[model samples]
Target: MLTEVNLAFNNLQGSIPSSIGHCQNLLAMSLSHNNLSGPIPPQAFELPSLSIFLDLKSNYLTGGLPLTVEKLKNLGAFRVSRNRLSGLLPNNLGSCVRLEALFLEGNLFEGPIPSSLSSLRGLVALDVSDNNLSGEVPEFLVSFGALKYLNLSFNDFEGVIPSEGVFKNKSATFVEGNNNLCGGIPELHLSRCNSKTSSDTSLKLKVAIIVVILGVTLVFSCLLILWFRKKKEQPTTTCAENSILQLSYQSILRATDGFSIQNLLGSGSFGSVYKGILEESGAIIAVKVLNLLNRGASRSFLAECEALRNIRHRNLVKVLTAISGVDYRGNDFKALVYEFMEYGSLEEWLHQSINRNESGIMRNLSFFQRVNVAIDVAYALEYLHHHCETTIIHCDLKPSNILLDQEMVGHISDFGLAKILSSDRLNYSTNQSSSIGLRGTIGYAPPEYAMGSELSTKGDVYSYGILLLEIFTGKRPTDNMFKEGLSIHNFVEAALPEQVIEITDPILLQERARQGTFTEFTLNDKHLQHLNSIFEIGLTCSAESPTERMDMSDVVSKLCSIRVKLLHPTRVYRERQALYIAQSAGIQ
Candidate 1:
C-alpha cells in the first residue's frame, strides 16, 4: 500500500496525516491541489529516501517553510507555491544541491534571498515571484551558468538588477515592480547610478544659487511685477487631457455604415463590438460601443479605464482612445476604440458555429499553437499578478474573454472585473457584502464565491482551472458525465481517481500528424501520456475549493514540461499513440 502517493487535485481536506512520513519506500509524493492546511510537517521534508519529486503546491499550507526541508538532499524537484508562508527563505535550501526546479512563489516570504542559493549550481528553473523579498538579488544568481529561468517579480528588492552575464536580454527573469531596483537593461528604464549621483550634486548647486539670489532681495517694484504677470497670462485648457484624439461621431457612423450587422464582429454582455476602418488613416480598428449604459456599468467603465491606463504589456489589447460625447440623438454615447483582432475570441473558434450549415469543422488548434497561446496568456497574467505594482485579480477568465490577434497570438482582455490588491497597506471594500452577489458564471466560480465570501487570487485560479479543463477536453464545464450524470468536476474527480486516460479528449486519439496541426506529422503513446498528465494537472487546478488550485506560475511550469516532453518524439510517445489508435478501433 506504500506506493507513490499522488493525491493531488482532489477534494481531499484537512492536514496531511503525519503517518505519511512512514512510507519509507515511497519514491515520489505529490499532495498538491488539495485543501490541506497546517504547517507542512517537518517529517515530510525529513524523509530519508523519497527522491523523485516533492510537490505540495496549490494548497492552504501556512507557517514559514519548515527548516527540516533542508534535509531532503536527494529531492530533485520542490514546489510550494501559493501558500501563506512568510519569513526569509531558509539559507540551507542549497543543501538540496541537485535540485533542478524550485518554486516558492505566491507567498508572503520577506527578507533578502539567501546568498546561499547561488550554490544551487544544478538549478535550471527558480520562481520566487509575488513575495515580499527585499535587498539586492544576489549577483551570483546572474552568473550561475546553469539557471535557465528566473522570476523575482512583485517583490521589494533594492539595488540594481544586473544586466551583465546570463541575466542580459532574458525576458523571463522579470525583475519588475521593485521600485528601489535600478540600472538594469534599457528596457527597464531604471536610473543609472552615475546619473543619480550627478543629479544629486546638480540639485545642491541649484539650491545654493537660489538661496544666494534670495538673500539679495528686490526693493518693491509691485507695479512692475503686476505688469509682468499681466503680460504672461495663461491659456484656459492644458491642450492635452481635453484634446480630442478620436474622430467625430459622424465619421464613425460613415465607416460602420450606420451600425450595420455586416460590420459587427461580436457582441458581449456590455456591448456589440464592430470592425471598422478610420476614414483619415484608413486604419482598421475594433470598436466596442456601450449598449445600455446602465448605472451599474459605471464601475466597470472606470475599472476598464484604470486597467488600461496602467498596463503596457505586449500581449494585452491596446486602447487607442475612448469616445464619450453628446450625439445628435441627444443621448450621451460612449465607445472604446481598440487595435483590431482579426481572429476573434478563443471561445468562438473553439465552440461557436462556423458556417451556414453548422457542419464546418471546429478550427483545429495545433499543439504548438495551444502552447504558444497558453504562454502568451501566462506571460500577461505574470505581468498583472506579479510585475504590476499591486496584484490584479482577473475575476472573469472564460475563453470568450481571451482574444486572438491577426497573428493568432492570445491576449487576455476585459478588465472590468479586475481588483487591485495593494501591498503598501491592507484595505478591504466597504461594499464587500454587495460584491459577494457579483459571482461570475456559475461553474467557473470557486467554492468561496458560491459560499459568498470575499474574493481573492484563489478565485481566479479556480476559473483558470476550469479553463484548463475546457482546453484539454474540448468540452464545456457543464457537459454531462456518463451514467453518473455529474458535471465536469465530478467527471474529472471520478476519472482521476481511476486513471487520467479515462478523461482524455476522444478526438486526440486520431493520428495527431494526420490532423495537420502540428509541425511534425505523427502521434504516439508518449504524447498520449503527456496529454494524460496535463489532464490530471487540469483536474488539480479545478479542484472544488480555491485553496486546492495550483498557482498560475506552477501551472505554467507543469504545462511547459509536458509541452517539452511532447516535442521530443520518443519511442514511448509512438508506442502510446499506436496503442491508443488500436484500442479506439477495437483492435485486440
Candidate 2:
C-alpha cells in the first residue's frame, strides 16, 4: 500500500483515503469496481507525475469534479464516469493538452460546455452524454480534427447547430441525442433552419414561388382529370383495423409518457426510439417516431406503415400499431409501434458506453451465449433470404439492427431498405442501374453491390460475414484506423504470421488473464491462438468474392461447433485455436 496499489472489481466499500496522496512514485492507480464515496481528493487531481491511466469509475463518488484537475499536466487518460457527480466541468480543463481521452458522461453535470475545451488539440475522444448540460453547442470543438469520436448527447442543447465547416463534414453518428438540436448535419435530416433566418426564408420563398407557378399551369388539367376520376374513386375517410386512427397521437403520447428522455432507448436517421406501454393491452412496446419533414427522409416515413403492415415474420421486429394524425399546431405526424426488446440491440450491448466498465459486458457473454446470438441472427437472415413468400434482402445488417430480448435471443429490426424479390424475377433489384447504386450503409454492403452487379442471396452472405467480423472482434465497420489499413483483417493476418500480440481488444486480454483461461501457455501464446481462430472466421466471411464466402447455414454450423467444444473443454477446440494461429503465421 505504501509504494503502489491496484484494487479493482472486489466490491470493496467506502471512501478513498486522502493518504493516497503520499504515493509519490505511483505509476498507475486503479480503484474501480468498488463501493467508494466522497469527492476525489484535491491532491490526486493535482498530481504532476501522474502520467499514465487514472481510472475511478463504477463507484458511489459524488459532488463536483475537483477544480484542481487542470494541474495534472501529463495525465494521458482520465475517466470518472458512472458516478453521482454534479456541477459544470472545470473551465481550466484545457490546460492538460497532453490528454488523449476524456470520459465524463453518466453524471449529473449541468451548465454549458465550456468553449475553452477547444484548446485540446490532441484530444482523440470526448464523451459528455447523459448529463443535464444546456445552451448552444460550441462549434469550435470540432476544429480538433484529430477527434475520431464525439458524443454530447442527452443534454438540453437548443438552437440551430452550426452547419458550416467541420459540422458539415461529420457523420450522422457525430450528433444524434440532442433533442432540441436541429439542422447543421445533413445526414440526420433534422429540420432546416428556422424560417426567421435570412438564408432559410430566401430558400423557402424561391421553392414556394416555383410551386405556385407549377400549380397554376396544371390547374385546368387537374380539374378535368378530377371530374373524370370522381366517378370511379372512393374517399379513404375510414382508418384501417390496425390503425391507431384519430387516437394515434394520444396513444403514442400515453405509451411513451410524452416522449420523456429516459424513455429514449436509441436514435437514428429513421427517428428516435422510445420504450412505452400500450395502454389498451398493457403491453410494453418500442415506438419509432420518424422525422418526415426533412428533405429526402419523407419517403421512409410515408412508406414505413405500408412496409411493416405488409411484411410478416417471426424474427422481424413486430409492428403492433401505427398512428397518423395532425398535431395541435397542424403539423402532420406518424409513428410506428414495435414489440419492446428488453435487452436492447446487440450493438448497444457491445459498444454503448452506458452501464459499462473496463471489464465490459461483452466479456461476460459465455461461449454458448455468444454462439446463440450469432445463430439467432443467422436463422433470421436465413428466413429473410429464402423462407419468405417473396425473398426480402435486408440491405443494412449492422449490430444496431440486431435486437435482443429479455432472454437474450436475437431479432432483426429496421426494414426501411428491404428489397422484395418477385418469384418470376431472377435479379433482386428493380433499378436499371443495378444494385450498386442502391447500396445500404458502407462496410456491410457487398463487393458486388459496389460493382453494380445483379443482386443475389450471396450479397447478403457477404454482409453477414462482415457482421460476423464485428461480432467476433467487437469492432465497428466504419472505424477510422481501418482507413490507414489497420483493420481486423490486416491486423489478424499480420498477427498470425508473426505470432504478435497486437490484434486483440484489451478487454479480452484482461478477461482471459483474470479467469486464467490461458494457463496452458504464456499469456501472449494463448491470446494469439484464441484470437487467430476468431479472426479467421471474420476473414473467411469477408472474402472479396461472394462465392468464396460461406452461407449463413455453414457459418452457423462452424460457430456452434466451436462454441460447443470451447464450453465443454474439448481438447480438439484448443488444438484448433493453436493450429489456426500456426497456419496464419505459415509456421505449421
Candidate 3:
C-alpha cells in the first residue's frame, strides 16, 4: 500500500529489491544519492501505478534500462542519472508521454537518442549529458514547446545545432563539450559549417572576408579613439540617467488614457499605479504616478530612482523607465514605468476575498506555491544583502510590496525607503536615518527598528520572516487576535513541533483533504513535520534580537532543503519520525 518512498542521501547500500514491485499502490520512489549498485530491477518499472516519479540518480546502479519502463505511462518524472547504466536508451520510453522531466546524464548511455522520445512533448527538463550519446542532435527537440532545460553536452553529438525553439535561447540549452557541434544561434559562439565545395574557392572567399574585416576594424578603431577623447570632456552619468526612456509627458498621458480612474491598479502613500499601454509597440506596462502633494512624495520618487538605478534581479520588479517633467498645466509630473504583472500583488491573493470565481470557493495558494514565493523573496533579499555592489536594505518587506507575475513568480517592489550601506560600515547607512521616524510598514518592521536602530540587512530578514509566517498562517501580522502581547511570532512559536496543523491556513488543509491525503482524523506525521520545519524557519528569522536572526543566505538554503523534503517525503513513517527526532536534537 505504499504510495511513496524516498531514501535519498541516506548512504543506503546494496541493490534495489525486485520485491518492491509488489507494492502495487506505489506512486513515487526516490533512491537517489545512495550507494546502491547492481541492475535496476525491471520489475520496478513494470508498475503502471508509479505516476509521480522514480528517481535513482547518483547511485552505482548498472545494466541496461528495462523496456518495461514503457508501462509507467502516467509517470511524471523518470531520473536515473549518474549511474553505471549502459546500452541504448529504451526505444519504448515514448510511452510515458506524461513525463515532465527526464534525467539520464552521467552514465554510459550509447547510440543515438531514441526517436520515440520525440513524442514526450510535455517534458520541461531533459538532461542526457556526460555520456557516450552519439549522432546528430535530434531536430524533433525543437518542436518540444514546453521544454525549458535541455542538456546534450559532453556527448558525441555532431552537426549544425538547431536555431529554433529552445535552441534560440542560449541560457535554456547546454550543448558544450560536443566538439563537432556548429551553427547554433550567434550567442552560442559555435563554429560555422563548411559547404562541400572546392578548397581553393573556399580559401579565396575566407581571405577576402578577412581583408574586409581588417579594413572595417581599422576604421572603427580610429573612430572609437576620437569618441573616447571627446567623451572625457563630458560629465559622468549614472545608469538611471543614461537609460531613462525618452517618453514625453504627452506620450505618457495618452498611454494612461489621461490618467483615468479605471486604469488604476493600486494606490499608496507616495503615488498611484495605473495600467498603461505604449502607443508605439503596444506593450503593456504599469505606471506609478507620483502624488506630489503628499508629504515626502517627491523624495520617495528620488529615493526609488536611486535604489533601482543599478540593481537588477529576477525576483525584483524591473523598472523599464522613469519620467520627470512638466504636465500640460505646467505642474510637476513624475512616474515610473514597469512591466505589468498580470497576477497583481500578493496582498490581494492573500487577504482579499475577490479572488474566487463563479463557484464562490476561495482561491488560495497551494502549500508549494507559498513555499516557492517565500524562496523567491528570500533570494531577492540575499541578492540585495550580499550580491549587490553595495548592500541594500529594503526597509519595507510586506505582502503588498510583493507582486506576482503570470507564472505566479514573486517580485519584490516598493523600494522608496531603501538604503545603501557604506562599505566601511556594513551595518549602518548614512543615506537613510532613524531620524525619519519608522522606516517600514507597521507590524512588518523589526522590533529594533521601532527603537530607532540603524537600517541593516537583518531588518529586512526580520520582515521577510514575518511575511513567511503570514503566508502560511493566512493571518496578517496586525490581526486583532494578535493583541495583548500575543503576536504572530509567538502565536506560531507556541504551536511549533506539536499543533502546527491547527495553526496552518485552513485553505491548505482543505487542499490536502481534496487530495484524500489529510483530514482532522488522519494526521500525517510527515506533513506535520514539514509544517514544523517551515514555522521553525520563520521563528528563527523573526527572532527579536538582530544578532539571533538567520541570515538571508542561510534562510534560502534551509527553505530550499525543506522544499525538497516536501516534494519527496520518506516512505516509512518511522524513518521520518526518527529523522525528525534527530533534527530536533541538532544531530543533523
Candidate 4:
C-alpha cells in the first residue's frame, strides 16, 4: 500500500532492488544522497504510477540509463545527477512527456544529447552539466517555451550557441566551461564563428589578417597602459556593490518619507524595516536601515550583502539594492532595499489576531497552506546548504523572518545572522576560532550553541524544526507554558500519534470542522495519522543530538510524501485494495 518511499541522506547501500518494481502503486521514490551503488535496476523505471518523481541523485549508481524509462510516462521529475552513471541517454526517455524537471548533471553521460528531448516542451529546469555530453548545442532547445533554467556548463558541447529561448536570457542559462563553444549573443562574449570553407580564399585571408593585426595592436596597447597603473589606483567592488542598484541616501530617505513611523514594516536586532515606493519607477520596496549605534550592526550589514550577492532562488527574498553613505547630518548610513512582499511576515499570519471582516472572525493559515510554507522554507534551506557554491547557514530561522508573497508563497528573509561555510571546510570543529561566538536568536537557536559548539548547517536544521513545529501547533518555542524542563520540542514530542489532536492548532481543527471532516466527538483517523507523521518529522529534525537531526533534503522529501498522501487519499485506498486482492490470491 506504500505510495512514496524516501530513503535519501542515509548510509543505505547495495543496488536498488529489482523487486521494488512489484510495488505498482508507487507514485514517488527518492533514494538520493545515499551510498547505494551498482546500476539502477531497470525495474525501477517500469513504474507507470510514478507521477511525482524518481530521485536517485548523489548515489553511486552506474551503467547506462535503461530504455525502460519510457514506461514512466506520467513522471513529473526524474533526477539521477551526481552519480557514476555512464553511456548515452536513452532516446525513449522522450516518452516521459509529463516531466517538468530532468537533472542528469555530474555523471559520466557521454554522446550527443538525444534529439528526442526536443519533445519535452514543458521542461522548466534542465541540467546536463559536468558530463561528457558533446556535439553541437541542440537548436531544438530554443523552441522550449517553458524552459526557465538550463545548465549545459562543464560539458563537451561545441559549435555556435543558440541565441534564442532560454539561451537569450543570461541569468536563465549557464554554458560556462565549454571551451569550444562560439557565436552566441554578444553577452556570451564568445569568439565569432569563422567559415572553414571559403569560395575566395585570398579575400578571406586578407580580411582575417587585417582583423588579427588590429586586435593584437589594440590588446598590446591596452596591456601596456594597464601595466603602468598601480593596483591601488583601481577601485574594487564586491559582487554585492556591482550587482545592486546604486541608490543615494536622499532617494531612500524620500522613498521612506524620511524613515517615518507610519511606513515602518518591522524591526530586528540590527535595524528597522520600512515600506517605500521608488519615485521614478513607482515600485514598492522594503527598506532595512541599520542601527549603526549597535555593536554588530555594521558587520550585519556586510554579512547580509555578502550572503545575497550571488544567490538567486524563488523561495528566498530578493534584494533590490543596498545603500551605504552619509546622511544629511553627515552620519554613517547603511540600508538594503528589497522587493516588497504584500502579505507581510508569516508571524503575523500565524499569531496576529486580525479581523478579516466586520464579523470580527480571525484569519489563520489552513493546514494545507502551512504545509506548503514548510516545503517552501525547506527548499530554500536545501538550496542554501547543498546547491550554493558555498554552504550558507541561515543561523536564524523563525516565523518573523519568513515572508509571504502576493501568491502566499513563503520566502526566507533576514540574512543578517547568516554564516557562509567555505567549500574546503564545510564543517567547523568546536576548537575553531570561528566557533567562538554564539549566533542566532534564543528559543530558535540550538542548545549546542550555548555550549560554544561550532556553527553548522545542523543549527539551521534545528531552527527550521522548531519553526515547523510552531506552524502546526500554533505555539511558539518561548510560549509561557513551556517553562522549567518543558520546551517546544519535548512539548510536541510528548504528544505523539494519539494526542496529536490535542496539541494541534485549534484553527486547523476548526477548518476541518467547517469541512465536516471533524466534529466535537469525532476526528478522522487519516487526518490524525497525517498530523502524527508531520510532528514526528519535526521531532526528528529538532533532536537534541545534532547527529540525530534529519538533513534539510530528507526533511523536504518526507514532507512532500506527507503532502502527496493528504492530497491523494483515494489513491491510497485504491492501493490498499490492490494489495489485499494480491495477498488473497497468494493465500489461495
Candidate 5:
C-alpha cells in the first residue's frame, strides 16, 4: 500500500538494504538528508515500481552512479546530489528516458561528461555543478527538446561555450565557477576564444599554397601540350541540364530481375517503383512502372515526366529519363527511371518501428534532422511555386511522396497531379474540372481541394503543413485519434506552446538521445519560443481558408530565420517569427 517513503530530514543510519527492491508497490523512495553511507544498493535500482523519484540526496553515498541506474526506466527524478559518488557517470543513464530532474551536483564524479547523456531527451534540469566533469560544455545541451535548468558551475569544463540554444541565455543556465570556461553569448561576459579554428590549419594552408604554385607551372605546360594534341570541341551552354539517357525496355528488364517483386520498392495508385541498377553506369535507379490499366495512370506518367523535365532543384527528385515501349509480354509497358534514394521516404522514417538504411542497421531520424528535412521541403516548394519558369503546384504532397537521399535531405517527388500555372493558363477553362477528383491524397489533401475549390499553391502549402506536423508529432493527419471534430490542426492548436510536448512524436524525444548535438531541453524561454513559432507556422499554413495561409516566400524566409536562430542565436529570431505570425494571423 506504500506510495512514498519520506524518511528525509531524519537521522537514519547504515546503508539502504538491497532487499528494498522487493517493495513492488513503492512509488517514491526518499532517504535524502539521512546518514546513509556505502554504495547504493543495486537492488534498490532494480525495483520496477519506483517511478516518481529516488531521492538519496544530502547523504554520504559512495561509489560511482550504479550501472543499474538504467533499471529505473520509469524514474521521474533522480537526486543523489551532495554525495560522494565517485568515478565516471554511467553511459546508460541515458536509457532512463523518463528522468526529468537529475541532480548529481556536489559529487566526486570525474572524467569527461559521458557522450551518452545526449540520449536523455526528456531531461528538464541537470546539475553536475561542483564536480570534476571536464571537456567543452557539451554543444548537444542546446539540442535537447525539453531541458530547462542546467547547473555546470564549479566544474573543470573548458573550451568555448557555444552561443546557440539554451546557451544563448546565460542567465537561465548556471556555468559559473568553472574558471576555465570562456566565450559564450555576449551577455555572459566571458572572454572570447583565441582560436576559433585550429592554428594547424593556417600553417597547412601556407604549405599547400607553395606546393600549388610549383605544381601549377608544370601543369600549365602539360595542359598547353595536351590542348594542341586534343581535338577542338564545340562549346556547350550551361543554361539548362539535359535529362539522363533513356534506356530500352530490355535494358530495364535486365537492370531489374525481370520485374521481380524483390526489386520492388513501393507501389501506388499510379504504378509501382522498383529499385534497379544501370548495367552500363553501375548507378542505382528507381524505375517507376506505369500501370496502364489504372485510369488516368498514363496521363499521370506523362505529367510526372513533363513536370520533372521542366524544373530541377537539388531538393526536388532528379529525373534520369523516361522509357516508353512494350515490356517482355509486349502488353504496353511505360516507366520513368530516376535516381534511387538509399534512405527511401520520410513516411517510413516517421511511421516505421525501425528504419534501416541500405546497410540494414536500424536508424532513427533526430529532431534537427526532421527540421532540416522540413527546410529542404520548404525550399523545394518555394522554388516550385515561384522560382520555376511556370508555377508548378505539386498536387500530391505527402510524406510517402517526399523521398530522402543518403544524407537525410528531403526531395519532393511525385508530380503526377502537378499543375503548371503558365501565363496563358492563368484563367482556367473547363478542362481543369477533370483535376477536381485528383487534387492529392485523402488525408493530406486540403479541405479546399475536397470542396472542389481550384487547386492552388496554397493547397501544396496545406499538405506541407500537415506533413510538418506529422514529422514532429508522429501522427498522421488522418490518425484514428482524430474524430468528433478533431484534426491534426486543432490537436496541435489546442496544445499551443505549453502542451506541444505532450503531443510531439515520442520518437523525437528518444531520437534526441542518439543525436550528437547536446540535448538542449525546451524548459528555457528560448526553446519554448522557438517551438511556439514552429507550431504556429504549422497552424497558419494549414488554415481552412487558403488565402489566409502563408505563401511559400514567407514560409521560406521565416523557416530560414528559425534555422538561423538555431545556428546563430545572437538575435531573437523566434520572437521575430512569432511577431510575423501574429501579424499574419491578425492577432491583436
Candidate 6:
C-alpha cells in the first residue's frame, strides 16, 4: 500500500531497475542527486500511479529522451534536468497532457524543439536551459496559458528572443548566455543585433575569384541582371498608399499649448505625452513630444512613426500624423499624433498606480472588460505578425501600451522598439529578426533579449501574456512582494480553476461572489470556465520556451470563442436561468 517512495540524495548508483513500474500504488518516487547511468526504462513513464512527481535530477543518466514518456498521463512533475541525456525531445511528450511541470535543463538535447510540446496545457513551470537545442524558438509556448516559469538560458537557441508571456517577467525567467539571441526589452541590457542578414566573407571571396577567372565584364553584366531581377520581385508600397499624415512642429505645439503640464498625459523614457486638439480641426488627439536632449528619443520617435506608417487594424492605435521640425527656439522637435483614448491605458484600470488625476482614486476593470482587452491586443498583434505585408514585432507590449477608448475598446500602442521582419520570411514557419537594440520595459521584457536574440513576433506574444495575467490578477510582474522564485506567473499558476479566487483581484472576486448568489448558477459556472480558459491562454503565451508559446493567430481565435461562450450563453444557461427564477418564486 506504499504510495510514496523517497530515495533522494542517497548516493545511489547503477541503472534503475526495470521492475520498479510494477508498483501500481506508487504515486511518487525520487532517486535524485545520484550517479545512475543508462537509458530510462520504458516502464518508468508507464507507471499508472506516478501522478505526483518523478524526480531523477542531478544524475549521470545518458542517451536520448525516451519516447515512452507519453504514458505518464497523470504525472504532475517530470524532472530530468542536470543529467547527461542526449537526443531530441520526444514528440510523444504531447500525450502526457496532465504534466504541470517539465525540467530538461543541463542535458545534451539537440536539434529543434518539438512543436508537439504545445499540447501540455496544464504546464506551469518549464526549464530547458543549458542544452544544445537549436533553431528558432517555437511560438506555441504562449498557447499554454498556464505556464509560469521558463528558463531557456545557456542553450544554442538562435534567432529572435520572444518578448511575450514569461519573457515579460525578467526575474521569473532566465535566458542568458546564448549570444545569438537579441532584440528584447531594453531592461535586459543585451547587445543589439544587425537586422540585415550578414553576408558570408568566404562566399564573397569565392565570388571575387570566380569573377576574375570568368572575366570582369561578363561577371559585371550577370551581377547587374541579378540585381534587376531582385528589384523587380520586391513588393512596393508608396508613401501616398500608406496614407501617413505629415504634420508640422508649429501645428503640434499649438495643439499641445506649449506642452503645458495641464495637457501632459504621461511621460516615458523617450518623451512626454500630451492630450491635444488640432488648431484647424477640433478633433481630439494624443501627441507624444520627443525630448531631443535625450539620447534615444529621436530614434524612438522614428521607430514609432515607421511601425505605424503602413499598418492598419481596428484594435491598433492609429497614428494620425508625425511631426519633424524645429521648435520656436530653433531646437529640433519631433512628435506623433494619435487618436485619443478617453478611458486611458489598461494599466490604469488594472493597478492602483500611475493613473493619477484630480480625483486621486484608482479604477478597476470588470471581468468582461479584461477579456475584451485581451481580444483587442491579440487581434492587433495577429495583424502585425501574420496579416501584414511585412511582419512586425512590437518589442514592447504592456498594459500601459494598451489604451482603452471611450467605448472601452482596447488599442495597442507604443511601437518604439518594433522590429519589422521581411514578408518573404513569413512564408516560412517562423519569421526572422533584423534589429539590434535594447527593447521593452524591465518587468515586461523577455529574458532572451539579454543574450542577444533576434526580434521575433513571439516576443510580442510573450508581452501580451504578461499583460493578460496582470489584468486578471491585479499584480505586476515587478511587484515588490514577488521575488526569490515567487512571481506573478507562479503565483497565478499555483491558484488555478478552483482556487483562482484566492489570487484574483479583490474587486473581481467580490463581483463574482455577488453575481453568483443571484445570477443563474450555469451563468456563473460559465464565467469561471471562461476565466479558466483565459488563464490557460496567458500561461501558454508566457511560457519559457518561445516555441511553446501560442501564436497570436491562435490567441485571437481562443479569445473570440471564450467571448461568445461568456456574453451569449447557450440555451442551457438560459433555460437554467428561467428554472432558477421560477423555483425561487415557488412556481415549479
Best-fitting candidate, scored by TM-score: 4
CA lDDT, candidate 3, residue 358: 51
Residue range 1-588, candidate 5, lDDT tens digits: 777788876657789898887787888988976668899988888877877878887666899877888888888788897667889988988878787777787677888887788877777667787677888777788897566567787677888788787777664577765657888888876767776374675688888999989799898899887655431221111112344464777777888878789998888776888888879878888888878898777665555555566665667887777866555454666787778887888877887654665677566777668778888899789878865666777777898888998768799887343333332333433245235335788778899766667767898899888888888888888889899999999999999877867887776655334555546444356555766778889889999888889987667656655665665533231223322332333221
Please write out the lDDT profile of model 2 over residues 290-325, one tens digit for every residue: 666654344454434444554544456767676555
> How would you encode candidate 3's per-residue C-alpha lDDT over 1-588 as one tens digit per residue?
899898886658899999998989988899977778999898999899988778897677889999899999998878897677989998999999988778797677899999999999988778888788999898999999877778887687888798999999887788865767988898987878765434766688899989878799787889899767534432122235525355656777788998899898888767788888889878788888888888666666665666676665668887877877666665777888777888877887787465664566556687778988998899789878865667777778999889998779899987343333333333324434443322788898999877777778888889998999999999999999999999999999988777888888877765446764645533378777877888999998899999999988667656766776776654221223333432333322
- Please write out the lDDT profile of model 6 over residues 1-588, one tens digit for every residue: 778888865557799888887787888888876668888888777786888788887676888877778888888778886677888888888888887777787677888888888888777777787677888777787566766667777676767666777666675556665646776666665557666544564577788898798798887899999767633443112232344344566666688888899999888766778998887767788987777787656555555566567666667777777766556665666777788988888877777666554587445577777777888788788778865567777777888888888768898887343333343533322212333233667777776765667667777788888888888888899999899988777777888878766666766754434433423223267677777778888988888778999987668656765775576533121223322332333321
Residue pairs with backbone overlap in model 1 = 9-540, 524-573, 524-577, 525-573, 525-576, 525-577, 526-572, 526-573
- Residue pairs in clash, model 3: none
Superpose all Cα atoms of candidate 1 onto the true structure and report the RMSD in Å to 1 decimal: 11.5
- Candidate 4 per-residue lDDT, tens place, 338-361, comes to 878888788888884542424555
Judge candidate 4 against the unseen true structure and give its global Cα lDDT, from 0 to 1.
0.77
What TM-score do all the candidates reach, one by one?
A: 0.53, 0.47, 0.59, 0.64, 0.53, 0.52
**Global CA lDDT computed for model 3:** 0.77
Q: Is candidate 2 or candidate 3 better by lDDT?
A: 3
What TM-score would candidate 1 get against the native? 0.53
- In candidate 5 the C-alpha lDDT for residue 302 amounts to 53
**Residue 134 deviation, candidate 4, in Å?**
17
Candidate 2 lDDT (Cα, 0 to 1): 0.63
The TM-score, computed over Cα atoms with residue i paired to residue i, of candidate 2 is: 0.47
By TM-score, rank the candidates, best first. Answer: 4, 3, 5, 1, 6, 2
So what's the TM-score on candidate 5? 0.53
lDDT of each: 0.66, 0.63, 0.77, 0.77, 0.73, 0.71
Candidate 5 shows a clash count of 14
Q: After superposition, how far is residue 138 of candidate 6 from its true place, in Å?
A: 46
**Segments in model 3 whose C-alpha atoms lie over 4 Å from true places:** 1-148, 151-162, 165-245, 352-354, 357-361, 415-428, 431-438, 512-523, 569-588
